[model samples]
Target: TAAAPPRIFPQAQHFVSKEFCQTEFGIVYPPVISVSSGELIEVETRDCFDGKIHPPPNENDNNEYNPAQALQQMKRAEFNPITGPIHVNGAAPGDILAVTLLDIRPKGVGVT
Candidate 1:
């Protein structure tokens, strides 16, 4: 049989440290990982709230206010954390960052 194809993770598979996360001001930190030109990588991204909304039993337990109030109380700096800069070796400025999605498998059961 042929060798199994390598798995690609275009998004982050887990939560990244706050240092690697981008702020709401649009400032992006250094690249987390570097890849050669034309290389394929799987990048994982965080949810908009960065997992602040927990599951039942503990979900509302953390926040006394309703969802709306809770959302307002959340800090602006802790929203929409993305996975990586994914530096492409030898890539120059103004180069377009092209990413191709190979597959997306949703974990757990939830409505979008």
Candidate 2:
């Protein structure tokens, strides 16, 4: 069966890279993008290895893939490169916000 076309959110504030990724949560790291409450947003994320893990170089060379290599080369003391600083409007410290998933599409080239 054929796949559906990617969903587009014309009103969504899109974030499609790891440029704003942070290892730890701190005040010094400001929000990369901010939007009002109930606003749609899109965030593309990297793998937990910070993109160190990868598919084999060739179709026949599956053994070439190694997770330990990626882990050793990671920069953060923690796992998963968290990308966000989305400041939601009207969301105060004491208030709780909820998120709804409209759709999730896997893009090209996932780590094997």
Q: Can you list the residue pairs that collide in candidate 1? A: 9-42, 9-43, 10-42, 10-43, 11-43, 11-44, 12-43, 12-44, 12-45
lDDT of 1 by residue, 30-86 (tens): 777777766655544557777665344556466454555556778988777766655
TM-score of 2: 0.69
Off by over 4 Å in 2: 1-8, 11-16, 59-65, 75-78, 107-112
lDDT of 2 at 32: 86
Task: lDDT for model 1, please.
Answer: 0.58
For model 2, residues 21-45, the per-residue Cα lDDT tens digits are: 8777777888888778767777766
lDDT of each: 0.58, 0.68
Model 1 spans > 4 angstroms off: 1-19, 24-28, 55-66, 109-112
* Minimal lDDT window, size 10, model 2: 1-10
